[model samples]
Target: MGAAIDPQVLAARVRNALPAKFASEKRMFGGITFMVNGNMLCCVSKRGLMACVGAAAEPEALARPFASPCFGSGRRMAGFVTVAPPGVADADGLNYWLALARTYVEATPRNASGQKRWRRKSAATEPSRAAA
Candidate 1:
């Protein structure tokens, strides 16, 4: 399926708020993700915006209206929160979340080598997409 508008707009707004040197965009999980210092800073998925504010801030971030603990696939991601579409309807609201994520991202260390730190599982570990 094609990408949805609300998430797309949310992603764009956050991307704009990030410092050029701190943010790099990558498309993943059928949405846009912003990486900072080789770590995932934030992303906008079909459900809405997902922010990684570090483990310490997750509780406060989840208190916002329309905010919820975030998950990837079926498992919960401890440091992330999902800001619902209603929560980020306006630019100001969008930036508010962006600022939260930026704070944690800014404090994180960067890998100057610039090599990708994550590795995908081998195709052999899973079922094939091709029909039998």
Candidate 2:
């Protein structure tokens, strides 16, 4: 529980700021993560704007007002930062963070898909539980 904006509102803003092409979204880490070409660009959640600004840019991003290190599972997440609600209260503020995420994501290698590459076993592939 932090100074977070409504996830829906933030999600709408993200949709407006980023292009649909090469962008996809998924529910992860208790919120929705926007992925670009398979890499996480940013996320909107109750915790705030979780941005994947890359490790090199992490320091500068954290230096900005209302920005703090992003944490997951009680540990600091490298190359990510959480911008508090005040930091993204206005459209301009939100856009700024989105731009940073876009720049970083663009430079990364593209995956086969814009979504996670996790492989799930289908019913046919799954071991027969009854036999076990």
Candidate 3:
């Protein structure tokens, strides 16, 4: 069997494939998130890539290979669908999913908590300026 993919590498590949106008951030979902205009486009998890393609397109997205609920079990993610492993093997497929995700996130409401939850606070440092 082929070597298992490292989620971090998968996430980086997806992020690098996105257009320059877009920006990406690593989040706590155990994945890397790509954003366009401050909206999350896609996320790459340990399993595969999750594309955000509105509820209307959910059924269709799910039909694709390796597609599944963003969260393994439990509540379903309304607009998110996972991309098959083979699909994410190259930039063409990666871009395809990223475009779909961008469309969905752009239309959806911003998750204020999402960003806040993932923000990493700087570690406390020893006194840089000694008190007199």
Candidate 4:
């Protein structure tokens, strides 16, 4: 196994690599997720650096060293890849993944609301509703 990753260090690197405009951070997937134009671009979590490289590029991305498909609820999350710490231990490697994610995010069509279309909310995070 590779050296353990420092979450704070990896988060800082992701922040530094992101463009100043059109980028925002949110807590999701048990980590810090970077969004571009209201769409998920990448995230830093225990699993490593997860990038939304788009479904078309998924095959190629997975072929790269230390890259693997991201899974959720026992199913593959198409278009997302988790790169191990060793893959993003350096600036160049991180930049490569970030760039790929950025390109895909930028190409995605924006919703009329100009906000994230959907996200699964945990019970704790979801707002409660009561019959009036």
Candidate 5:
């Protein structure tokens, strides 16, 4: 049998290796997602590391030993790629995936409605306008 995985440790390692421009958020998917400039670049799930690469790179990634589609749908997860288990086991491999994610995130435009779609806070924070 394989060794048990520690999600917290994996998250910490990934967070430390990522560039300062990136930010991390704990996701309900039982993984931590790394975002660059407010855009999601990568995620660390129970399966392994996942990066958000566009469709162009999907073919190459799929042929890689530790690479796979980010989801089971068979359709490439937009802006996301799954890093093989071996890749997540070491710093070098993890760094490689992070670099790819960073590049993709930097090149892509920020989602127009991404913020409004994912924001969890209440609308009370908005300032009230005087009624006419």
Candidate 6:
């Protein structure tokens, strides 16, 4: 059997690196995922870090050491890369990936469902000042 994933360790790092609010956690993909602005930022899986970079960043991310395409079923998962311990051996390395995921999550456009992933809750949920 493989090693178990430590969610507390991963979650603590994310809570420290990211803003206190606007981020939520959920259990999915057999791991604990950190979601930013309603979009998936990353996940701590039994394998390692599963980063949700935009499709445009996929090729470059794959070229990096210890990074490989995340797989599911019989297909390669697009826009997601798994980085093992060798890739994020230190805080700096983990921070680098966190930054990458943040940048992509912020820049990505709203998808077909009309859900705005990157918009802050304050802007989307609260009534506008003009309306008030």
> For residues 97-124, what per-residue lDDT tens digits would candidate 2 score against the true structure?
9999888989999876645568888999
What does candidate 1's lDDT look like per residue over 2-100, in tens digits?
234566667767767776677788887667988877777778877778888889989989888888887778999898898877777788878888889
Per-residue C-alpha lDDT of model 4 across residues 87-129, encoded as one tens digit per residue:
9999999999998998898999764334555888998886777
Collision count of model 6: 0
Which scores better on lDDT, 2 or 6?
Answer: 2
> What C-alpha lDDT values do all the predictions have?
0.79, 0.88, 0.69, 0.86, 0.70, 0.79
lDDT of 5 by residue, 1-132 (tens): 123356677788887886565674748345787776677777776677777777777676667667866664556465457775676798877787777777777887775435576666566876566532
lDDT of 2 at 93: 89
State the lDDT of candidate 3 residue by residue for 6-37, as single tens digits. 78888767656766656747574667767665
TM values, all candidates: 0.75, 0.82, 0.68, 0.81, 0.71, 0.74
Per-residue lDDT tens digits of candidate 6, residues 1-132? 234446567667767887888578888888888887678889886667889988999998889888888887879989999888656656887898888888899776534333654866766788888987
Runs in model 6 deviating more than 4 A are: 1-5, 110-132
The TM-score of candidate 6 is 0.74
Rank order by TM-score, top first? 2, 4, 1, 6, 5, 3
Best-matching candidate per TM-score: 2
Q: For residue 91, give model 1's deviation from the true position in Å.
A: 2.1
Question: In model 3, where is the ten-residue run with the lowest total lDDT?
Answer: 120-129
Superior by TM-score: candidate 2 or candidate 4: 2
For residue 55, model 4's alpha carbon misses the true position, in angstroms, by: 0.8
Clashing pairs in 3: none
- lDDT, model 2, position 54: 96
Give me the candidate number with maximum lDDT. 2
